[model samples]
Target: MFLGLDVGTSGVKAILVDAEGEIAAAATTPLSLETPAPGWAEQDPEAWWAASCAAIRDVLARRPSARVEAIGISGQMHSSVFLDQRGAVIRPALLWSDGRTTAECREIVTRAGGEAQLRDWVCNPALEGFTLPKVLWLRNHEPQGFARLAKVLLAKDFVRLRLTGSIATEPSDASGTLMFDPANLRWSREMLDAVGLPLSLMPDVGGSAEVLGRVTPGAGKLARLEPGTPVVGGGADNACGAAGVGAITPGEAVSSWGTSGTVLAATAQPRVDPGLRAHTFCHVAPGVWYVMGVVLSAGGAFAWYRNQCARELAEEARDDILVDEAAAIPPGAEGATFLPYLQGERTPHRDAGLRAAFVGLSLAHSRAHMTRAVLEGVCFALRDSLEILKALGLAPAHLLLTGGGAKNAFIRQLQADVFGLPVTTVNREEGGAYGVALLAAVGAGAFPDLQTAVQRTLARRPPTPPNLDIHRAYEEVYDRFRKRLVAART
Candidate 1:
């Protein structure tokens, strides 16, 4: 059996898969975020370790006779975890959704000569969500912590460090740091120098599926596993999510709607957007790359609405209540529009200071109308990335839709209408954890390569075709929404 652990923003998930890619047992332990100040999102590294241990122990207990030969990890990308000389976590780890580094991002661009030069070097604009900005923020804000910094690791690598006593990261996660070159598949020395950081502060980079080390005796005890279990270098969450859905080949794409929304297209080459509107990063699959567009608040916006306005319906499932209310409203929400920038944005506009609002609201607009508007706004935000990808000549024939938002029929149809393309959901819609489990399968020699593993495990469903009339009607609404968003940013 192979084990896959995903250190997600909201929880830690552990799953065990057999040689044939069938899951034996899966478990998840919930995690909480700390926001001491505005725009600052954090979690204790120790909390991650504790959650991981609990999840792994539960999974093992469920299948007492299962012997795992190898392990693979996947995690949220671009977060910073600082380790002191003794390998102790210095502070709470910063999260990708955190927006506390706007000035630091600007400083990075300035040091690199300009936004253009920075994008030229890293294939992405230096944004607050990237890892380099978080490192710089620590250096400037807490000089004492900076003085003790021995190594900086991304979310999963830090967990991997605890499991194997190895300090290393994979290309897919490293490429999102704004300090690595996706084209060359290495850390950019010039980028490190531009940020006034030394190469020693970063972990060693490795292939996504390469076996890094064995689980140490100490970690084995906590995780309820034998020592010396091999651990593979895992991938960034979205990269692994793409792999999970069998979207690794060119012409395939995955649109994920979690706390954040992501539209990623697999490609043969590193496809950079000329305007620095999208991010080009290394794919976990060997010899390939992907371009991604992100929406900072997608399902998160709907959750906000449910918490604030629909609390009375909390006895029922929130999504079910939301869908029932929203399904009755028309596609355009009767001219009401919502801007889903509750945590700033990444794609199209890299503005970290942008805020969300409801436009064209009136007494005639009911709570149901607002509910549909929120769903429509999220779909429109996703389409922004689709538009950028099409501009870069990386359009996909269909999008493999995954996450909570994909479960609702109304929202899925809305995505189809907004994107003007077919949207699909696969049989194994397990997201990142399932993808990394397949990576473990490769590392364990269960399959010859990733493609064969995907073929054996993944089953596809028919595509949800778009309604052309709704698609045509949405064009004008999208244009008006885009114009208002640009105006609001100014």
Candidate 2:
């Protein structure tokens, strides 16, 4: 058996996979986020360690007799975890959704000469969510914390450190930092020097599936695993999620709508978006790269609507009630258009200050109409990146839909209608945990590489082809949505 751990924003999930790429057991432990001020998202690093251990133990308890071979980890990317010389966490880690670094993003671009030179160095623009800007925020706002910072690690790397006492990172997560050169597959000295930070603060970079270290004795007891269980350097959640759905080569893509939404396409090379709209990052699969567009609020937008307008349905554990309500509305939501930029956006707009709104709302519009529009808006935001991918010649034949919203037929159809493309789901859609488990299989010498592992494991359902009539209707609604985005700048 191989273990895979994903340290996510909301929780830590652990899964165990048997040989032949089958899951033996899985478990998750919930985590909480702290937003003490507007636009600031933080989490206690120690809580991550606690939740990871709890989840690992929960899963292992299910099959105590199973012999574990190796472990792999996947996690949310672009978050910053600061540590002191003693390796104690210096402060609550800044999260990817945190938008407190707007000024720092501008500062990074200025320091790098401009957005053009910044993209030239890192293959991405300076975005508030990226680690580079978060680092600058620390220096500018909390100089004392900056002085105490001995090292910085991405979310999963910190968990790996607790598990194995090793300091390392893989390229997939590193590429999101705006301090990594995806084209060169290394830390960008240009960006580092421009920010006045040292190379020593970063973890050593390695291939995603490489065995970084064995489980330490202390961590082994806590996780209920044997000491010396090998641990592989896993991947960022999106890269691992892409791998899980077998989006490992050109001509393939994935569209996921969790709290956030993203459209990812694997490429043979790093393809920088000239407009700096989409991100080009390293894939967990060696020698492969991917272009991804991020929507800061996707399913999250729907959840917010549910909490504010339909709390009873949510509290009753019937989110499908929402689907039933929204599905009854027409394709265009009766002229209502929702802009799901609640937490700012990362893709085409690159605007962290953008807010969300319902355009053309009136007394005639009900919660159901707005709900349908919210769903449509989320899918359209994903399509924004799909359009960019198409322009870059990285278009996939179809999109593989995954995440919390993918389970509902209504959402599946809504995505197809808005994107004007066939979409499908895979049987093994356990997100990052399943993908890292497969990576662990490769690291444990059970497979030659990730490509062979995925091809052997993945089985796709029939495609959900787009409804041409509804797709036409969405074209008009999406146009309204694009035009109304200006209203969200407030």
Candidate 3:
């Protein structure tokens, strides 16, 4: 058995997979992100480690420890985890979704010769969500904490340190830090100096399949694992997710709609979009590149509506309103439109000031109409990403769908119609965990390579075809969205 762990924003998940790639056991523990101020998102690194250990213990309790072969980790990207000389967490981790460093991002862009130099080095424009800006934010706001930093690591690296007493990160996770040069696959000294950070603080970069070290004896007792079980260097959640869905080849893509939405496309060459909308990062596949466009809120919009807007309906059903409410409305939400920018947005429009709004709502629209419109709006936002991918000349051959949103047939059909593509879900929806398991298996020499391991492990579901008439209707609506975005920008 191999253990795969995903340290997500809200929770830590541990999955035990047997040599045959079947799930033997799984466990999860909830966590929270702290918002000390507006646009500032933080999390206790100790909380992630504690939750992960508990989750590991729960999973191991269901299976024999001796059967566990290796461990792999996949986690949220771009979060800065600082540590002091005694290896204690210096402060709360600044998460990838945090938007408190806009001024720092602007400074980096200016020092790096504006957006052009940033694109030349990182293949994307500077953003407040990235690690460098967070580092700068700490430098400016918490000079005491910045001075005490002995090591600066990403989220997964922090967990790995707890598990193995080693500080290291994989290339895929490193690429998102904004200080790593994706083209060269190393930390960017030029950018680091520009940001006034020391280069020695970063961890050594490794491949996703490389085994960093074994679980320490102390960690073994806490998690009920073998003392010497190898731990592989896993990747950023999205990179592992791409591997999970078997979207390794060029022209293949993964369209994921979780709390946030992302459209990821594999490419042979690093290609930056002219507008710096989509981010280009090095893929875990080594020689390949992947471009990703992120939406801040996707399925969260529907959840918000269910909890905040349709409280009466939710109170009446209390348990079974999701399906009934979603089924009551027709496609396209009966001409109602929603802008899914509740928590601002990423990709195409990197504006933090923008707010979500429901447009074209009429008195005839019911609660179900608003609910369905929320779902459609999420898909339309994802379509914006797909359109950007197409413009970059990297159209996807097939889009593998994953996450909680893919479980709903109503939303799945909406995605198919909006993108006019064959949207397919994998048999297993746990993309990040599955991908980490594959990396562990590869590290254990169960498979010759990552690609073969993925081919053996990944299972596909039937494709959902787009409804041509509905797709045409979406084309017109999408055009309106495009026009509105352009007008807003101007």
- Candidate with top TM-score is 2
Give the higher-TM-score candidate: 2 or 3. Answer: 2
Better of 1 and 3 by TM-score: 1
Quote each prediction's TM-score: 0.97, 0.98, 0.95
Clashing pairs in 2: none
* Candidate 1 per-residue C-alpha lDDT over 21-72 given as tens digits, one digit per residue, 9 for 90 to 100: 7788999999998888766789998888889889999999999999998899
By TM-score rank, best first, the candidates go 2, 1, 3
The models' CA-based lDDT, in order, is 0.89, 0.89, 0.83
Give candidate 1's whole-model lDDT.
0.89
CA RMSD per model (angstroms): 1.5, 1.2, 2.2
Q: After superposition, which runs of candidate 2 have C-alpha atoms over 4 Å from their true positions?
A: 314-316
Tens-digit per-residue lDDT, 1-490, candidate 2? 9888988887898988888778889899999978888767899989999999999989988998989999999998989999999899988999999999989988887888898888789999888898988888888999999999988999999999999999999999999998889999889998899989998988999888999888999999998889999999999999999888888887789998777999999888888899999999999999899999999999789878888888666477657887788899988889898999988899899988899998988999998898888888898899999999999888777899888756888899888888888999988768888899889999989999999999898889999999999899778888888888888987
Roughly what TM-score does model 1 have, to 2 decimal places? Answer: 0.97
